[model samples]
Target: MHVRNKSLTPLCGSSRVARLLVPSAACTLALSLSVWSSGAAAQAQGPNPPPLAMGLIVKLKESQTPSVVRLRPSVRPSDAAPSQRARLYAAANRKRVGFLIQKPTAFGAHVIHSGQFSSVDEAEAEAARLRQDPDVAWVLVNRLEQPLAGRVNTVAVPQSGGVYDDHFWLKDRTARPGVARFATAWGRIGANRSVAPVVTAVLDSGVLPNDDFSGRLLPGYDFVSEAQYARDGNGLDSDPTDLGDYLTSGEKQSNSAFSGSSCQVGNSSWHGTMVTSMLAPPAGSGFFGPGILAPLPGAVVLPVRIGGVCGAAISDVIEGMLWAAGIDYQGSPPANPNPARVINFSYGGSGTCRTGSATDTLYRQTVTALESKGALLVAAAGNGDGSVGVVGPIMPANCDGVVAVTALRKDGTKSSYANLIDGSLSAGYLGIAVAAGEFVSGSPGVTENLHLISDTGASTAVARYIRPDVDGTSFATPQVAGAAALALAVNPGLTVPALRQLLRDSATSYTNTYTTYAGSAPLCSSVNRANCRCDTGTCGVGVLDADKLVELALDLATNSPQPDFSAPAVAATSFVPQRGNGSLAGGGGGGGGGGSLEGVSLLGLLAALALGLRQRFKSGRP
Candidate 1:
């Protein structure tokens, strides 16, 4: 596999990279809060309006040709197709709709331009008319999707004095809910040198290979199809390096090209870098600490650039998803050598799963495709404000078979920024939740939201960009993905549904603490949407507990009944429903688990079982 920036050494080992940092300085400086633009906030209210008149992505029934006039990219001599006449529809009350038939996409959809419209409403009306055509299978407006996170308040200052621990969430805690007690889990992962490196794909803004990633990056493809959004001077390409996504003042003007575009004008969010580093930063790269998956022998991250300055188009996102799962679909880019076991979608927008709309059908189909490949899809529940009137988590998160994860504060109550299930049948989506904080203390009354994020648009420069007080479901999503990767590292054969069950089952219950930064909090429901406590039925299964998750995975590998050892394992379609107690559920199928126990004897299985039991009992869950 081709790794980006193969010459760059690991962050801790590279003196050259270290020179880019400032002397160990510390400051409690308060930076201005750069919140999401109103454009993004408007997206939470409904499905993003399709680009004014760029085109609509539509899939046709098998062997059916479009009746609308097909317009090719050019009318040059080399270009074959020209304008063709179509059947007239008086009900549409429009002349012939001219279409530019772009190349077929990886998801079997065709991008076509059906005449430019005056407004989004006009375009949507045209789309509705097209959906009624007999040849069309499904139609998508090709709306844009934004990263489901925002900078609440962050400053890239030096570490505070005294014994500093940047990664406080990983350590075991007795007072409140902590992520994972890495003692036994890390030790076992470190000792297993023969285990194959697990790949977790980050589908976000493009990534650049920095020292923090070191030896854990795989060759990725840029799926952004628009040159303006990509800002890379070209469309899709092999290089997924992030060019600056920052929009200028001129770009946001009413007469500018970005006027109707849903993208907000802001600084380039090195989103992919931040998420990748958090998921698998090198073991000792940052101040004597490791990321959730850094301790494993080989924890590889596949960076698939699907978003850009204007947010990712739905077509691009689906294409990136299919490619990341290593599925061989028509018109896809080169096959991915390293297929991801756990795919992290740290971005989302407004939309429910069962809306019965074309968007809903598209997401459901794509997610189902990923599951068939035995890859688990983990998505953020979105950072929609509580005032939006609970509609459950955002699209894709509410999609079936997906493990939707919401965010919580260090106090184990729902983070005010995260969107959650509101106990309404319309808003109910079964999944998991995790405390989004990196540091939380009771007596000192301090809750620092620290994350390994990029403070600069310059992808190569490391500097001192440990963004403190970063809050969003975006930050919380990757932790779950990394924990899922760690579980897969222990048992590579865990099926997608089974992995979801194990992770949900092993999660720690919410403390149900009503106290929060917003003062006395109430329980969140379909109506109570403010700063509130989370219940299993409302938020998710519970807060993520990596220690218990890995322990249970180990137990399942040793104790589960052996299936046929002849052919590869096929993942089951349905999974065990969410529950509180930690119990292994769902049958396993293909997921690179072939021959995992082919040569091992019964005695070895028994020994492994004993080890898992010992770690579980002695790990001190309380």
Candidate 2:
């Protein structure tokens, strides 16, 4: 099921696309520069388009391409430019076909050409030949996979923000941890405004331009790989603008692409718009008062679109995350000048993440790589309450090194629909909680009314409306991300663990006095499933207190150095030797250097450390 905006109320009238004879220059430019392939436009608008593979994702053995040795006979492919590396490899292969970089990817993997095969047989043969090379680690065809997000079947009851202002959540006297006290923190950290904008990436559905994000949004990349799911009449280019994710009734029933996946017929959620707006809403929009990071002029949001009409794929999400953090690899997109210090995930799939699953392994490697760059990840703990039977937070969120965020109702109790982390099974990844409003019974406040782009019936006509009663863990995630940006503004050198601990330490304690549920709501766990109270073990350390979080950050920056609780790696294990035939020369199971040492004992850790240092010394990686 999708964690989405539950309701929508149209504010203004719709205009027909044909009625506008002279479209604005901006609109004309967007159309003129559209990157639709010859026939891709027709297919994108069709009921269903076959899943397409851009190429094969291949990982290279790191030792094979170490820093070039002077006056060496062996030619170093890594020394060449990324675009020219293919030709260099081809020369090394004695005239055989070689792979070209199709797109950049995370870990040691990169998306490479599948060759000019006349048929499926020819393609497989080429892949097999490439796999036999000593430099290649693994070769897998990039299949089209979908992320888990579907619409919730709920009727819309139109409500306006007239009763109370749209920014009610900004300061709710009735709620615990009511709208993070950003104002109090701003007073102390205002001097840090001159620093460069702390880039925070929002990896979700593509965003649309609006007044809320005037000068704050960076030109982000769209990672949706397929034309049909992209819904933009183009495969993957540079544009990250959200067209519309709305699906037609015919497509939902007739198209296997939409019918077979976790997709349902619904209006475009404008999810990205809602998320970014929360981070930097206009200063004095009479409706949406101000955002969490509005005071910090140096904080900007990067809108990296990982999902589209259908959901996103695991591969695309991983690629987007790495690209957002400013890691350069072989990719079509230009280098990210404004790499994000904090990345926010407002979407997730179901189920607990496994240790050795392909997706899980890839995500772990990506996270480790990002951590090396000093970036932090904040993700939504899926919206699977007792009703959905999901035991813990979903993948990526449950992945190590990510700060998973769960939701709390206005009154400071666990949200009725938020997925609770089973601490016993979570492996110490339980995350913080924030007040994402629940307008249902027993909750004290109204739902959020945020401005977002919505589809009008007429094609080419889109308008901004205030979506009422918007509630989900999807919305709760950005609060923590914006807070992280604020924290980074004060101290640019904070590590991932430091920011995580700071958020937890400054959080408000959970309140036991529920307005309506009283003593009925039990502590949420695998056994008690739904509508339960959250303890520190299951939900997080405490409710997010932006005011306290920033105060602590400023104090740490001015008074003393932040504590370092990290287990620093003693050696690099990824530099194993490569055989002459392009295979790993030693160390079985693909040169196991990047494996997680989370639960290893001190003795085991020391033994591994000694072995790793010996290997590093042998490989000459001082």
Largest lDDT belongs to which candidate? 1
Tell me the tens digit of each residue's lDDT in model 2 across 1-622.
1111100110000011000100100111111112111111210111111222334555555443342221111111232335334533653274264554354454435555432112223434555666767666555444332122211112222323322244555553454443566566666566554533577898876777765567768878898765665678776668888765555557657765555433434445456766777786645533345677776674388888876554455567777887787654334256566778899887665334564444455566566646645578888776552222245566667887888887766556666556676566544564887766553533212353222222221223254344333455666788889888888877765666667778878887665334433446677776765556777767776777777887787777777553221222321221222222322221111212222232332333353446545434533478
Residue range 1-622, candidate 1, lDDT tens digits: 0001100001110011011110000001111123211111111222322323335665543332211121111101111112111222221234334464364553344565532212344546667777777655555666553333333334444433211264556666444453455544677666655444688998877776655677768888898776765778788899888774555546556434466444344455566766776776667664424677776655488889876654566777878887887754435676677778789987665567676776667677677657655578888776553222244677777887777777666666776556775445333245777666422223111354644555543322344454544555666778788888888877776766678778867877665333323436677776665457788667877778787888787787777632211112122111111111211111111111112232222333343344334334433333
Candidate 2 local lDDT, residue 281: 61
Q: After aligning candidate 1 to the native by TM-score, how far in Å is the CA of 438 from where it should be?
A: 10
Ten contiguous residues with the weakest lDDT in model 2: 10-19
lDDT agreement with native, every candidate: 0.53, 0.52
Task: Provide backbone clash counts, one per model.
Answer: 4, 7
Q: After superposition, how far is residue 281 of candidate 1 from its true place, in Å?
A: 1.2
Clashing pairs in 2: 2-150, 133-582, 134-582, 134-583, 135-582, 197-298, 386-530
